[model samples]
Structure formats: C-alpha cells, structure tokens
Target: MDSIRFENVSKSFGKTKIINNLNLSIEKGERLILLGPSGCGKSTILRMISGLETITTGNLYLNGKLANDVDSGDRDIAMVFQNYALYPHMTIEENVGYGLRIHKEKKDVIRQRVKEAIDILNLTGLEGRYPKELSGGQRQRVALARAIVKRSDFFLLDEPLSNLDAQLRGQARKELVRIHEMYGQTFIYVTHDQIEAMTVGQRIALLNGGDLQMLDTPHNVYHRPANIFVAKFIGSPSMNILTVKMDGRDLVLGGQRVELPEMWQKKIHEKEGRGLKMGIRPENVVFSREKGPYSVKVNIHYVENYGNRVGFYTEIDGEELISIMPEDEFAKGEDVYWNILPEKLHFFDGETTMSIGYPAELS
Candidate 1:
C-alpha cells in the first residue's frame, strides 16, 4: 500500500490556487523530495500532509487511510522546520522529551526514549546544555533529536538544514541518511536546494506554478527531463538550450545545420518543418584543437576555473553555450572548436514545450 497518496489534490487561498490537481503516491520507506522554486506550493503540500493546512479539494491518504480530516497531533508524524525551534529555557534532554511529556507518557519511557535519541544524535555530554548555549549546528541536531524521540515512521523536514553552513549542512545531510536507514522510515523533505534533493532523495517531485511538473527517480528527472522547466531547474549550470528548425532530417540552429545522432533522423522526418528545442548539458560538450565534422567555431567569452576544471562560456552562430572541461590553454575572445556528444542530445517540442522521446533503436 502507498504510504501517502494525493489524488487530484488542490489547495487555494481565496481565489488564488496554490496547488492545481496534484496526483502523487509515495511508497513506504522512500525518501521523496518536493523540489521547486519559491511560491511553487511545495511547502503547502507539506502543510496539508501535517494537517496544518486544510485541503480545498480531493483526498490525501496516509497509509491507506483518509487523512484530510485527521488531527496533526494524532497523525503520529514528526516535523523539523528550517528554524531550530528548541526551547531556550529547557535542557537538551527536556526539549527532546517534551512531546512525551505533552502526551503524558510514563516518566521511565520518556527517559529511555530521550537517552536513545541523545545517543543517536551524539549528544552525550551536551544533554545538560540549553539551546542558548549551543551552536547553530548543535541546535539543529536538538530539533532532530526531538523528532527522533517521537518514534514516528513518517518524517516531514522542511529545509531543516537550510540554516547551517555549507560544510555543516553536508555533514547533517549524511547523518540524516544514516538515521533514516537506522529507522527504516519514510522521509518527506521539502527544499529548493538542488544539491540536497539530488543527493538525499531517491525520488524527486518537481513543482512549478502550483503544478506538478515531473515526479520520478533523481537520475531520470535529471537525464530525461519531462519539459523545459525541469530540463533547466535540476542541473547546476543548467542545460544549454537552442531553438532549432527542422531542415529535412537535419536540425538547423542559428541558421546553421547542427550535427546530431542518426537515431533522430526518422523522428525529425516525422516532425519535418517544425521548430524544436535542442538541449545539451555543459559536461557533454567537448573542446579540441583538432577540428572535424560536427565541430563548430565558437568565440570564448569567459572562462571560469573551479580548481579541478574550468567552465567556458562561448557564443557560436549567435547561440550561447557553456562547456565545462579540464584546465586548458584558452583565453577570452579566442576562437575554439567545440563538439557535443551525439547520444546526449535532448529534443523537445516547441509548441507544447514537452520532451520528444526518440526511440532507442529503430528495427
């Protein structure tokens, strides 16, 4: 059974629609990331699942039970917000076990659960310390400890690591994976951070303008994006997109015929005389001193060195493209010959702005 399911779910505030007919099913024990830019309704989805926001339409099922009308406290779920909401007046132990106290659980049970959570969070000696005495990272861990002691199988984390520095966030992210493995629980992480979503989530649901853009494995969503929005949003440097016109079996970009894989020939013939969008990642682009077929002359505008490699932003036939490669002897305004991997080409329909899947092999 699906752990969480949203069937035609929609949320609105007055006349403004926040989520428009979202349909998704999250499996138990899965780490799913709701990723999108701000105001995309990702956070609203989390709020609805937590019972903090009322669903305007359709149903939300939790573990095969209708959860639209369920009380947040009775749902057996724990949430960690972006801000560490630890009580400043209480010790770490007291803060971690506060929920048990609220539920009026036995003192002995609370003590044992608090100890386990402390051990898991590596807060052996710091248990006596208050939130005001701890660092930001430590305070963040205290929030997690509170959730951990709750012993809920479902976790809702809303950018819980966003407040930490880069190094601390990296460390916390690894710990979160370890904790999830140890507990074997379902994690619903909401974030606009692409790095966190790419590394932490097994499946990613991308939202845009209150609409579900794409939902799939991280690899598929990265490599086989559903549309232009997804194609651009997930990548770090983003994919290089060029508007092209179909020239018989060739793709004419910038009024020049661009070399592409043979597999696209049949597809292009079927879509003859149509305008399409061509996508290629920066890493797939290669530069060589020796020029051959498919090589285009480009004027390098800027080169950014990242220690291990370099990024070359160049213009070719009026189309700007980015190519990341090893440190090479190239200067600004220099003419360079570059080529893109044929197999890595991404084709999209211009009108609908959706991916046009080319067959793997034509028999």
Candidate 2:
C-alpha cells in the first residue's frame, strides 16, 4: 500500500509563500485531483510530492515512511508533465524504455515492459513513430505510457491534457479515467479545469489562495461549498449572490421582501439584525409567466442557448441575475417574474462569508 501524507507542508521563495501549512492524506489506489485557479499551488503540491521541489517545512510520508529527504528518482513515483516531455530524437519504444535503459535493465525485460505499456495505452502499432509525427493526443498517450510502464506505487500528473485541443482533451479525459480504473493505482492529478476535476476525480482537494478550502467528494464540493470563495467558484453559470438586510421581521433585498422556508427562517433568525448574503444557483431560480409571492419582475437583458438548456439573463433592481430554462421556453426582452425556492437558498454571513447550513454536515 502506497499511502501519501502531507503534514503541515509549507513552501516559500524569497518573500512569497506558495503553499501554506497544509495537511492532507490519500489512501493507496485512491484517485485524487488537486483543483484551483492559476498560482493557487495545485501544481506546486504535485511537484513537491514528486520531489522536484523541496518542502520548506514539515514532513512528507509515503506508506508511513518519512520522505522529505527522498531523491526525485528514488521516490518510487512516476510523473506525467503538462507538455508531454517526450524526446523528439527518440522513437516511441526507446522513449518509453529510456528510464529502464539508463538503469541497465536487460534488453528483453525493457522490450517486454515497453510492449506492455504500449498495449495498455493502445499505442501498439505506433511503436516506431517519433514524437513530432504523432498527433497531440497520441504524444500525450506516449507520455502517460512512459509513466505507466514504470509501474510505480504512485502516479503524479500535472495538467497532462492542457496542451491538447478542446475536443482531444475531452477524449483524453475519458481515456485517463479508464486507465485509472484499469490500473487501480494511486493517482494525484492536478488541473485548473473544473470539468476535468468534477468528472475524473474520485475525490477532490479544492485549494484557493494557497489554502485548502475543502477536500471531499465532488458532489459535496459543488453543492455544499465550505465558504463564499468555493460557493462562487465551483458552479457553472455561477450562483447568484445578493446583499440582503433583515428589515424588522423580513429579509429584504432591493426593498423587496424575500420569502424563505420556515426551516431557513429559524436558521437565520438569530442573525436577524446582521447583514447576510443570499445565494441561489441559476438552475434553482424559477421564472413564472405571471407574478407570484416574493417575485421580482425583471427585464430580459439577453438569452444564451446552450443546446438542451437556455440561460435567461435579466436585470432585476439594478443587478444582473440568470435563470436557466429549457432552450425552447423563453425569449429575450420579455418581462418575467423570478423567484427562488426558499429551501434551496444559501445564506452566508456577510462578514465572514462562511455559509449558514447544518453545522455538523458542513464542518
């Protein structure tokens, strides 16, 4: 078993800190993705694990053994880089067997290992091809094949599919997931792509501003974000957030009374005199052809069609909000009433930006 553990890891250069005091653990054979925006230390974490970057403080453990001082080559790990890092002068087979060759492995053994990797990556008939002759996806496969051939205890991937075209990236995502399933090896994949993080990872570690926000299943990360940054970052079409005030006995936004479910009313009752932010996902807000209770009439600013679904962009009380509808359902420049289901509403403390939900479930 090759479990990976980071105990209060920190990294810095000059006056800039890249990774803060971070702590995490991953079980053997678990596929984990590190996701965040650029410069958020996602790739830095991967490089630290690969032993390419030295940790400034704390210890790294591999299968319960301290690995803070381990050499990159001796870490029993394989890394697939974003650029595919293949040797242009070498043929596919030679490139895949390069590491083993350098270690002075027997000719027959290297040949068998390379052949196995080629078969696993479906590069069987392309053994003699050069990196320059292959397509983007093919070269990526070659890179992954080289790593897979190592048969290491852990696989570290640093945005391996970013160089491919959008269409090819989608195809590669499926292939990578299939490869993980086939091998059942511990994989630490790093990417800034939210779709890739959502689709490929069995679990995700969401990092932001050099801080670990939440580490949970994709569903939890998406639906129950740890704080405001995550709540606004993880969803498509973005969740709509509005500043609200508790006016006497009502939650008021833009001088309009908002109706919330009884359960939610109790949840925010203690914070009645304080400021709050209400969030509603685009899909959770409904548009009615007629006015209803707590409904706000808005002018349709624009409409965007996403094949099966349509996003109705509107201006309500000097603020822009979107309502997702069926593609064939609505038109631009039409007046409509929009409202949110109280139970689905998310309330956050204005000062702290932390969500107000079930404490046990959230914490």
Candidate 3:
C-alpha cells in the first residue's frame, strides 16, 4: 500500500481554490519533493496530508486507510517547519523528548530516544544548550532531532533549510539525506528552491498555480519537460525558447532555415505548418565565433560572471536567449556565432505549450 494517497483532491479558501483536482501518491520509504513557487499550494498539500488542513473534496489516505477526518496529532507524522519551532527555555534534550513526554511515555524511554536522536544529528555534546544558545544551524539540527525522536511513520519537512546561510544550507541538504537514510521512513519535503528539490528528492512533483505540472525522476523532468513551464522553471537560467515553423522538415527560425535533428525530420512532415517552440538549455548552446552547421548570430545584451563560468543573455530574432560558457570570451554588443546541440533541442507545440518530443531513440 502507498504511504500517502490523494485522489482528486481540492482545497479552497471560500471563493479561491488553492489546490485543484489533484491526484498524487507517495510511496513507502521514498523521498518526494513537493516543489513550486510561493502560493502554489505545495505547503497546503503538506498541511492536508498532516490533517492540519481539511480536504474540500476527494479522498486522502494514509497507509491505505482513509484519513480525511483524521486529527493532525493522530497522523503519526513528524514535521519540521521553516522556523525550527524550538522552545527557548528548554535544553536540546528536553525539546527533543517533549513529544514523548506529552504521550505519557516513561522518563527512561524518552531519555534513550532523545539521546539517540541528538547523537545521530551530531548534537551529542550540546544537549545542555537551549535553543537560543545555539547557532542557527545547530538549532536547525535541534528541530530535526525533536522530530527524529518521535520515530513517526512519515517525515514532513517544510523548507527547514531556508533560514540557513548558503554554505550551511548546502551542508544541511546532505545532512537531511543522511537523516532520511538512517530512518528510512516515507519522506515528503516542501520547498520553493529548485536546488533542494533536485538534489534531495528521489522523485519531484512540480506544481504551479495549484496545478501539478509533472511528477517524475529529476533527470526526466529536467531533460524531457512535459510543458513550457517546467522547461523554464527547473533550469538555473531557464531554457531558451524560440518559436519556429516547420518548413517541410526544415526548421525556420529567425529568417534562417536549419536542418532539424534526424529524429525530428521524420516527425516534422506530419506537423508541417504547425507553430512550434524550440527550446535549448543555456549549457547546450555552444558559443564560438566560428560558423557551424546550425549557427545563429547574436548580440550579447547582458553578461553575468559567476567566477568559474560566464552567462550571456543575447538577442536573436527579437527573442532573448541565454548561453553559458566556462570562460569569458565575448563582450556586450560583440556579434558571435553559437550552435544549438542537435540532440538537446526540445520541440513544444505552440498552442498547447506541451512537448512534441526531443531527439530520442526509436525502438
């Protein structure tokens, strides 16, 4: 049985629907990332699963049992919120064991569980420190320890690393995976940050405007996006898109005709006269001054230098395209030649914004 399941679920606030006709299943021992921007209902979905928010329609199941009417406390989930939610007056051990104490567990059992949690989280020596006395990262670990001590059925973390510094956040991301590995419970993490979703999740459920855009392995979502929103959202600089027309198997773009990938040539005949958008990741656009088989001349409009690599926003055919290179080689207004990697091109139906296909192997 699935760990958690939502069938045709919808949530609302009076007149506004926050989550619309959603259907999702989270597997046992699987780490799923609920990813989207602010106000996208990702958090609401988490809350609903925890039984803190009511499901307006459809069914919610926890461990193959109906859970729509279940109380939050009875859900057997350990959630770490963005703010850590630690008590200022309690020491680390006290905070960690508070939940067990509330359940009337024996003092000895609570102490053992709390010790195991704190030790696993590297808080072994700092058990005596209060939440206010520890550093931000230390306190974040404390929040994790508190949840860990519960040994709950599911672990729900809602942007728990948001408050950490960049370096510490990166460290905590690895730490979270370690914690998950140690516990091996069903994990659902909600975050607006794409990096967290990509790095930590075994699978990603990308949502937007209360709609589930796609749910798949991270590689598939990144390389073979279902639609334009996902293609644009998952990448660092976002994929560069150009609307093109299929001229009897040749792609017509920017008043220039370029040969489509061989895999597309066979598919193009049936799609003639169809308006399509060709997407290319910034990393796949090779920048050089030399002409190539499929080349485009562009004027650099913006240069973003990130020490090890450089990003250029260029204008071509009235559309802004992004390209990244390892070293600084071009300047603003400097005309340059760049070629799109044939196999990396993604074709999208113009009207539907859904992927037509990418260059793929035919069985």
Candidate 4:
C-alpha cells in the first residue's frame, strides 16, 4: 500500500513557517488534490510527501512506516513538474525510457514499457521528435509518459498543466483521469485552478496561509463551505455576502427586509438583535418582475453578456452583488426583484466568520 499520513507535520524556513501543524492522510490509490492560491504552501506539502523538502516537526508515515528521514530516490515516487521538465536534446522515446535506463533495466523491458507509455499518451508517431519539436501539449504528454513508464507507487504532479492553454488543459485533465484509472497509483496533484481541483480530485485539501481550510469532496466544498473564506473562494463569482441583522421574524439587510422561514427563524432566534453575515450564490439569486416572498428590490447598474448567460451587477446597502441569469431580459437602470430560496441561504457568525450550521435540508 502506498498510503501517506502526515501527523502534526510542520515545515519552516528559518522563522517563516511554510506548513503549520497539519494532519492529513491519503489512502492507497486515492487521487487527492492540494488546492490553494499561490504561496499557500500547497507545493510545499507536495514536496514534503515526495521527500524533496524536509519536515521541520512531527511524523510522516508512508505505508505505515516512518519516512521523514527517507531519501528522495528511495521514496518510490514519480513527479511531473509544471514546466514539463523534458530534456531538450533527448528524443521523445529516449526521454520516456530515461528513468528505466537510469535504473539499469534490461533494454528490451525498457523498450516495451516506453512503447506502451507512448501509445497510452497518444505520442506513438512523435517518438522520434525532440522536446523543441513538439507542441506544448505533446511535450506535456511526453513528460506524463516518462512518469507513467516508471510505474512508481506514488505519482505527484505540481501544476503540470499550468503551462497549457485552456483547451489543452481540459483535454489533459481527462487524460490524467484515464491514466490514473488504468494504473491505480496514489495520485497527489497540486494546482491553484479550481476547475482542475474539482474535476481531477477524489478529495480536495484546500489550504490557506499554511493552514488547511477544508478537506472534502468537491460537491460538499461547493455547496457546504465551512466558513466565509471557503464560501467566497470556491465559487467563480463567489458567494454574495452581506451584513444582516436579525429583526423579529425577518432579517434586515441595509434598508430591505427578508422574512425568514420557520426553520431559520427557529435556528437564529437566539441571535436576534445581533449582526450576522448572509451568503447566497449568484446562481441562486432569482429574478422576478413582481415582488414575492423574501424579495428585495434593486436597480441593475450593469449587465455583462456571456453568450449563454448574463451577469447582472447591482448594489444592496453599499455592497456590490452579482446575479447570473440565463438570458438578458432586463436592461441597466431597470428595477427588479430578487430573492433566494430558504434552503439555499447560508449564514455565518459576524465575529468569527464561521458557518452557523446549515438548515436541516442542507445538512
């Protein structure tokens, strides 16, 4: 089993901490993604697992054995870097078989494994070409083929697709999933792209400032964010957060009032007279010509056309809010009523910014 466990592991460069006390586990054959913005210690965590970076404190277990002091070459890990890291002078075939050659494998075994990797990554006809002769996508495939030929127990990728164009990145993501399914290796991918993290990972470990923000399936992270940070960070347009005050059976936002459902009324009755942050995704904001239950009136200030969809920007109180609509039926300066479903609402504590728990339907 090629499982990895980090028990209270921390890393620091002099006095600057790169990874705080972190406890995480990756099961054998699990495809996990370390996702965060730049300088969030995601890459640092990946390096620690690959034995390229030393842990400053705590224990690291690989396959139920302590591996904090293990050598990088003996870790049985294959890594694919962001730059594709291919030897410019080596032909595609030579590059794919380089690891095997270095390990002193028989020539025949090396040739067969190289051929298989080439075919799997759709580089069969380009085997004779050098890295400079291939496109960005092809060179990336060659890099992947090289890693695949190693057949290491652990496969680590550090933003491997960051250099590719959007279309190529999407295609490469699917290829990665197919390859992982075929090999069943413990794949640990690192990326700042949310689309890649959501699609490629079986589970995502979101990090911020060397601290783990949330660790869960993509669906949960999207729909049930743990706090205001996760709520604002995960979504594209991000969840619209507004300061609201509990008033009797209604929540007051600036000058507008939204009646709370029975469930929420009961849940936040204790918080009456106190301030809270209300969260609603742009997609969840419904537009109607006439005012209805829990509706708030606002004038659209700007409209952005996205072909299949439109983004309507408006202001509530003093905070800007956006709503995504399927069509552009309303123009700027038009007054519209918008409301969110009771189950779609998320509430956070004003002081801590932590979630106050979801309603029964969402929970």
- lDDT by residue for model 1 (1-363), tens: 689999999999999999999999999999999999999998999999899999999999999999999999888899999997889899999999999999999999999999998888888899999899999999999999999888886899999999999999999999898888888678899999999999999999999999999999999998999999999998878998888777665666655676566688777666554568888888888876778677666778999998988999986566789998887678888887876566788888888888887657721
Question: How many backbone collisions does model 2 have?
Answer: 0
Of models 1 and 2, which has the larger TM-score?
1
TM-score of each: 0.96, 0.93, 0.96, 0.97
What TM value does model 1 have?
Answer: 0.96
Q: Supply candidate 1's per-residue lDDT for 108.
A: 98
Q: What value of lDDT does candidate 1 attain over all alpha carbons?
A: 0.87
Worst 10 residues of 2 by lDDT: 354-363
Candidate 2: the clashing residue pairs are: none
- The order by descending lDDT is 4, 3, 1, 2
Alpha carbon deviation, residue 335, candidate 1 (Å): 1.8
Backbone collisions counted per model:
0, 0, 0, 0
Using lDDT as the measure, name the better of candidate 1 and candidate 3: 3
**Residue by residue across 156-238, what tens digits does model 3's lDDT show?**
99999999999999999998999899889999999999999999999999999999999999989998899999999998889
Candidate achieving higher TM-score, 2 or 4: 4
Candidate 1 lDDT for residue 218: 92
Q: How does candidate 2 fare on TM-score? A: 0.93
